[model samples]
Target: MSNDNCTSNVSQSIIGVLDVIAPQIAKANGLLFWGVILVGVVVGIGTYAPRYRRHPLIGILFVAATTHFLPIISSVAASVTSTELLIHTILINDGLNSRVYCTQYAHIFLIFVWAGLVMMVAVNASVIVVGDARERRNIGPLKAVTGAVVWTTYLTISTLVDLYREKVATIQFIEQRTVANVTVLGQLFLIMYTKLIFKYYAFYKAKHSFAHGRSPSLVDGYMDQLQQLGDNSDTPTILKQGEYTEYDARLHPPALIVMGEDNAQVDNQPYGNRLKWIPGQGDKVLTLDRVWKLDDMDMLQSPSAQPKYLVFSFTLFKLLRCRFAKYTISSASFTKTQKFFRYTLIKGSGAAGERAFRIVVDELSFLHDYYNSSKPIYYSHHGFVIFNIILSLYTIGYCIYLMVIYIVLMAMGYHHSQIYCSDECLGEIFEADFAGKYSDYVQRPPSPVPCDTHADLIDGSKCTSYTILTWHIATTVFEVQQNQQQHDKCPHNVAATHLSRYCAYLVACYPELLTDNNDEWCKRLYEDAKKEAARVLSTPRGATATYPLIVDLLSTQSTHSVLKDGASLGKQLVDSGMGWEPLARFWSEMILYVAPSENLEAQAEAVARGGELITLIWAMLSHAGIDRK
Candidate 1:
């Protein structure tokens, strides 16, 4: 009986200890309940606010406002609940002087709340700052007011919860209710945080996927039209029949002589522009269809006219790989703060602005190439590889850093900026060729000619005539003609000839794509070239004239005097040893770069019009990493 009594006394002592600790646990649960509500409100605001509309970072700012108020709202509720719980405990404890009292658990729970509050503040502040940078706007006042409210509420709630714990009586009823509240709060926090993380991850993954798949189409419909034109005729007409007239027929009597003028009937067969139907013994006539030969015509017509996929050389692939790797590494090395500055403040403009800038730079570069064929040092294949590697690595690192920052901020109740640069932005750069110094964010080498520098010397009229002259020179450069053949052999002449004509085609049909601000100049140039071509065609024995002889005649005639006067720019290039080969390569590359850089919105609007050769080249350049912004 004595042992049983001792055991009963021990049990009573344990029960007494529990009674003392029960009130503290209940107060801690109340604090936890408010914490859970804070988390729920923050998550809810962040998730829905960013999706409210599509205007840069406006939605993100809205999120910041809502999240900034989370602590204030939670703290006010906590204070009121603490007071109610304290009064209830005192009334239920039989007025036994059982007052509310602060405990170790209450301090620890307040620490958690304060820590959570600080985290939320940090998150909201970061979102606001970054969003402002990205959108080029300021909403600091909103952030400040919200932050003040949160801090005030937190201090007030802390005092009330502390007071409630210090005065409330320890009781079984309060303990059970508090425990249930804590359990529910913990579960809700887990669910909400998980959802927030998943949403951000999915968004980042989608952007990455889109960037990887943004290769442009390398071939278009223009090549097919050229091919059809080539296939219908075995021998291209070097000059129209009207170019040769029967003025006196004194220059070449052997060729111009006819057996009978009545039977020939001017031979208007239309089959051969240079061929003439001369009366033979009977009504038959011998047609000289292959008299004047343009060697480059055969080469130009040999290639397939349809659009084709780009096939990069092994060297090109290695160069591009190195560039991409370098960009990734450099980007990875950026500090969190640096990344925030870059993505937020530096690259704040949306994708549309970035693309527009790219188009302007590309158009400028295209015009520059028409007058200047000197390639930049960085344009070499080796330099291209190294440069791109550095750029790509930096981009990669920056992207990764951004992802981390986004995740952290979102977890802390800040919403991500919705107006991120997309694959379309990258696509514009790739299609546009190298970036220019005028770009706000991208650092590029200074152009030899500034984008705004108007080359008045390179009007459309001069460029068109120069192109025609270049084509003529390229075609007959290696011909076997006895009197006109030069000893110098240039393998690139054929390529130069084809590209020259193509440039002329672009100048005539798509002048706006090259220079939106100089449409009048292009139109004047086309009309002048057309008139000059007609004049050349009407000259006596013009059909039989060699390219060099034509150049000599053009040089003397005031109508085509630009060729000799240096206004055409071809004489300068020729004197500098940038013969047809180098000039052709430069123009070809320039044309290709400019085609896709034409305002993509404009191109999309005219999708039914037809494709351009420049588009094909743009795609090839993109595939090769040569045109990356």
Candidate 2:
């Protein structure tokens, strides 16, 4: 009886041991195999992290490190760790058989994806910190920090949702699902709130600045003032620190002289506050918000207190001086021509902004009396300089810190082992363990086409056809150009066809145009002179250091007035229907012909609208000019 009982007990013990050890052994083997590979990839990536910014190779290293190592580690962890440990410690799994174990692979992918996202965020934050400090000196550090916090919070929440759903399987688990969903939703809400706050605040600040004739914000104001100072013309001639000079009450009476040296003495008659008055010179009145400087002789000229006002006035003064200088420097042949033009225009003109600019009127008065005798010494000026230096260093340090923290966190969150190399494998791995729908969202599209060849231009004939098509389509107010027989739906213009046709026409019309010596032919086809002149005119007024043509045009008072007014008039004309149409059509055709189809849509629409508007203007002009010729 005892022998039989012993044999039965021994067999049962062996079977029970095998049953318990089999799954555990299988999990252990899987973990060990993946763990080594993950470690190798992570170490390789980390070694090359510092070089990421300099070369594309480093970027590859970083991507591989985060994507591959994280997944491998995650996979190993899921395989090795018990379900209870995963649920309690890692916040993953449900007590739902082997399915829970299989779903745990998502946790591995979650970790790596999160690693990539965090790294990107960190890189962006570092860039912002460094860039803002250098470029936006007036904006306080608080602004940048606030933006970073808002952005980081959003990213963190997004990552958490990804982690919960993919890695932990919390999306399917009732106990953890509610918390996961709430975190995901809360993150989204916070992003929206932050965006709204930033947008409205920016708008308010801009409006406030515009109304006050100051910059919209403190930073903007400072930048504007600095720009003004940099561009101030009068300040440069009179004093070294003309922009910094303090202007006070004791100043000159207006209308001391008109032009040239002031040799004539006027009787001290009572004007405003017992100031002497000159007959031809207009009265000088102080205006608020205008910048002025007290000269060495301690007489006021431009405006006082506000530095930007002074700079702006000085710029205007310089412009006038430049005009006079141009006249003096004119060639003998040109001088007679300019003088004749100026004399005739001046005969009928009213008092100009320049002609009335007479304060003490002499070179000595301008040198001594217009500029401030003493300059301001503000503590703030020094403080600002010091602050800028400190801020620059601090910004650099902070960026480095951000970069390091990001890399470390990314390394911690994701390792190279996490990413799936094959789409088929990924789909199978995820779907086999979880629902098929879980894999759908993670699916990636194929790589895009690589750019290689340069584009060829359309020939004159093709170009002409394209021009005609544009003109024809534009006549319909951008309504989809319909076929004559069937107007039921908007027809696709397929502008590419027109472009091809035009290109063919250009080739046929001037076959030699394709040759290297075809510059003459190209010149005939393209209105190069007009294009160049328009380009010159359209360039921003103050951006260039020198504008010889602008200076020449401004030499005469009437011409100067005309040029200034012309800019405004041109802007108005271009904004109206006549200007908009041609511009729209040209841009549309250029885009449709030159750019990818996806990018051509907006350009085509613009072209069609512009052509239509231009045609209407042309028709109207034709009717007015020739009476329906």
lDDT of each: 0.35, 0.30
Q: How many clashing residue pairs appear in each of the predictions shown? A: 28, 36
Instruction: Point out where model 2 deviates above 4 Å.
Output: 1-196, 208-310, 313-402, 409-415, 419-629
The per-prediction CA RMSD against the true structure, in angstroms, equals 29.8, 24.3
Output the TM-score of candidate 2.
0.22
Could you tell me the TM-score of candidate 1?
Answer: 0.25
> Model 2 lDDT vs. the true structure?
0.30
Highest TM-score model number: 1
Off by over 4 Å in 1: 1-483, 486-491, 541-543, 560-580, 605-607, 619-629
Model 1 / residue 416 / CA error / Å: 76
